[model samples]
Target: MTGEGIKECELIEWHIKEGDVVAEFDRICEVQSDKAAVEITSRYAGTVRRLCHEPGAMVQVGEALLEVEVADEPEEEEDAAAASALGPMPPVQQLAPAEQAVKREQAGLAATLASPAVRRVAREHGVDLASVQGTGPSGRIYKEDVLRLVEAASEEVPGPSLQHKLPEQRAEQLSRPAPSAAGLPAAAEDVIIPLRGYARTMVRSMTAAGAVPHFHYCDELDAGPLLAARALLASDPALGGARLTFLPFVLKALTVALAEFPVLNSSLSADGKALLQHAAHNIGVAMATPTGLVVPNVKAVQGRSVAGVAAELARLQAAAAAGRLGPEDLAGGTLTVSNIGAIGGTYASPLVNPPEVAIVALGRVREVVRPAPGGGFMTASVLAASWGADHRVVDGATLARFSNVWKALLEEPRRLLLHLR
Candidate 1:
């Protein structure tokens, strides 16, 4: 809810449970919305009184997630501020109507009861907790019991293949193969795995993007200067071991072009009446991760040096790989650049990222023979660039001219220094 337009969110996990004492600003929970995974923190010093919702439950904006028993103090105004921070209580909704009932019923069984950690272990090993004999007090299962069950089951199996020996209940769930989202039921052969998490977010974003009118422009540029520029920067001592890639050069060149043609660095107003031109060139770089594609932008790219942009790019990549990207990292992108070249492509008609009016994707560079300025044919390193823009706002001539400006800066990177502050 920190950013606009996100109405619903899925609570990923809680950092503290009931009765846990917490200080102001302590991490409360991690939640995922349409944009990015965000960490909710405590604004009041208190003890966790009750958890209003469970993990994976969807809650709407301005809803009270949990009840906190704030420590009573003489400062009445401070206590009132804390109370204001806590939103009104609202109903929490789950993806499946029967999930809560099923979880409660399972927890009621003492004979098969197991802690979450132990249950997770059993699930990973395909050992049903009902089959593991509880060794703890009151017939409660423990981690050791699950491990023993796994070991004993492995001994009975002739080879490393344990799929055939999975507990009946585990095997049944696997055979059904339906989870996360609504999908078709499974049989012996086919299994329908519904998209969730980033995959789901991507679907929503792309669907929204398609509703807007789009036009594409494609051209190839001689990348001889771009390659040589990267080589020169790679050895710079001031860069301090930052991975010098063509991305930073491309980003810097983009900023130079964006400075002259700021209309491309704009988003359509919600009412579709006014075109909101952003002053800062917060350019997003489309990245591919294990989960899905995420565009985390560098703020104020026009103000940052090529080296500075490279450092931030590296930081974003590492944060994305670790799933630590926050709402700030994903929001406020005015325009985007996708290096499709890294993935072995030379051109792409990418959908313009919603809100932003345009996106540029770079294709793989190749050596080809072309006419030299001296007139004869010569071999040149060329990189393909594709541009997709909101045809409603940006005309073909504007994007073409903008693309030319970008191409000029990237081709002769030395010109980038003129615009450097």
Candidate 2:
């Protein structure tokens, strides 16, 4: 079970069955919440005695999911074996050529027990789970098992025309209309799916945000320098594969600007007479997850370098994608940045997350023709940036100055190097 915010979740699938032995921390099932699929691990070493809910059941938090007959503590040697089995098997590259083939054959023979999440991954990658070996307890197929197979498949070259169809053929096949479901009733008419979990929480949060007295400010920035800086950092091997992106640079610039104009980062008191300025720059990056829109912030961005910010952003993105984010990850955000450009949006007036005075939206970086300083029109990459702030705490003039500072830093990215921690 997760935190109190998530009221209920769907029991997507069970990894262990009644009478199956499970070690402490071994995954027993996977539940789909509004945010993502979560694996429920066993807290006690035991044998599953009863399953309280079947697959697809909407179960409440703190409700009994199942009953386990607790097992006695295991000896050191036995515990070591259990721990070893919990990890994923070695990669295909580690095995001998002949040994790999043998293992693949053995995998085909083994019964495949996969949770719904694992099955979804296999379907998305067009991989057959029946051919994947389960490294989990009772020979269960985990999400990692399917992912490994997908990765290996990607590395292999296409065989011939027989393996892949021509574009014309593919287009023709896809153009065909889907089969009609004339005999079945409409699904919406049959089932009333109430808003719960992530969807429900989003409604509440957005409604609160809407109630705030907010103002919008829009501007455009020359993004050529920011793009070049990202390319340089991404190519540096000394950074150890740390991939730099525009969002991190934006975060860095925002932190610096926040320091100069503390009012833009401050929150208005409930009484509306006082403003509370935060000491830490906990900037939240708005992310669209499979479950819902979640803004998980990296704490204390003012203390981190651009490289460090990139690493933290990567970590938060991965956790959000996997639906493994905890309560702490979703809390304490002082300001937010929404990178709408990743999805092709040109500009947007984003709403400010409540309790936070402001939120910024970064649009796509695209080439625009503009008058050159000393000559005719010139083409340059530009990003459309928009800001939304609580009118009670941040006035239009304050937001403009803050936005200018951010824009200047991005235009002359070299200045960021001087401010790096």
Evaluated with lDDT, which candidate comes out highest? Answer: 1
* lDDT of candidate 2 over 62-115, digit per residue (tens): 445665666554443223322211132222233444565466568764434554
Please write out the lDDT profile of model 1 over residues 165-240, one tens digit for every residue: 3465446655874466667575374343445457778898889899989989999898999899888779797676
Using all chains and alpha carbons, the TM-scores for the candidates as numbered come to 0.66, 0.68
Task: State each model's CA lDDT, in order.
Answer: 0.77, 0.76
**How far is 11's C-alpha from truth in model 2 (Å)?**
3.6
Q: Which ten residues in a row have the lowest lDDT in candidate 1?
A: 77-86
Q: Name the top TM-score candidate.
A: 2
> Cα RMSD for candidate 2?
15.5
